[model samples]
Target: GAGVSQSPSNKVTEKGKDVELRCDPISGHTALYWYRQSLGQGLEFLIYFQGNSAPDKSGLPSDRFSAERTGGSVSTLTIQRTQQEDSAVYLCASSTRTITGAVEAFFGQGTRLTVV
Candidate 1:
């Protein structure tokens, strides 16, 4: 894809249902990130994967949330036994490091998940 892309732009599910959100990062970007934004809130980092390093999962809010990047291009975020509080817009971003070790990221329009 030319840019970061996410699937199911909008999703509505009953409380307790499970949902999976997908992200396709831009080609050649080795660093991928997942963040969650509650209504009227700022983005909260959920997880991050860079190259072959172990993913940084410290940002996940709970055991119910998990994410994985396969082949370092596609990523999926799974929310198991979703709760109403889990409703949010999930955002994905990808970036490549600069020679100076800075990161420049491109973000996808988030997948809005609503748990009713």
Candidate 2:
């Protein structure tokens, strides 16, 4: 893909139902991240996958949310037993790692999830 791509721009689901969000990062990018933003809250880090290293899942809000990046490319975020508080815009970003320091990251339009 030319840039980070996410599916299901909008989602409306009943409480307790599970939802799966998908992301396709740019080619050659080694780092991918998942973030959550509420109505007024800042981007909350959820997870990170870099190359072949183990994913950094420290930022996940709870065990109900989990993500995985396969073959160092596409990624998926799954939320189980969704709750009303889970309603928000889920954002995905991908960046090319450089030797010196941080590099620019490309973000997807995000998936707006409304838990009814």
Candidate 3:
């Protein structure tokens, strides 16, 4: 993909149900990140994947939240037993190194999940 891509832009699920969000990062990008944004709230870092391994999982809100990246490209975020408070926009991003050694990340449009 030319940029990060997220699936099912909008989702409505009942409380206690589980939801899976998918993301496809740009080709050859080694760094991937997952974030959450609530209405009128700032972006909350959920997870960070460097290549096929995740070095930072502490940002996950709880055990019910988990994420994984395969082959350093695609990533998935899963939320179990969803609650109304879980409703928010989930975002994915990919970072790549430039010639100057600076890393810049490209972000997806985000998936909006509404728990009813």
- TM-scores for every predicted model: 0.94, 0.95, 0.94
- Please, what are the lDDT tens digits per residue for candidate 3 over residues 7-32? 98999999999999999999999889
Better of 1 and 2 by TM-score: 2
RMSD of each: 1.2, 1.1, 1.5
Superpose all Cα atoms of candidate 2 onto the true structure and report the RMSD in Å to 1 decimal.
Answer: 1.1
- With a 3 Å backbone cut-off (N, CA, C), the pairs that clash in candidate 2 are none
- Model 3: weakest 10-residue lDDT segment is 96-105
Regions of candidate 3 where Cα sits further than 4 Å from its true position: 98-102
Which portions of model 1 show Cα errors greater than 4 Å?
none
The models' CA-based lDDT, in order, is 0.90, 0.92, 0.93
lDDT of 2 by residue, 1-116 (tens): 77789999999999999999999999999999999999988999999899745458899999999888889999999999999999999999999989985599999999999999
Clashing pairs in 1: none
Ranking by TM-score: 2, 3, 1
Clashing pairs in 3: none
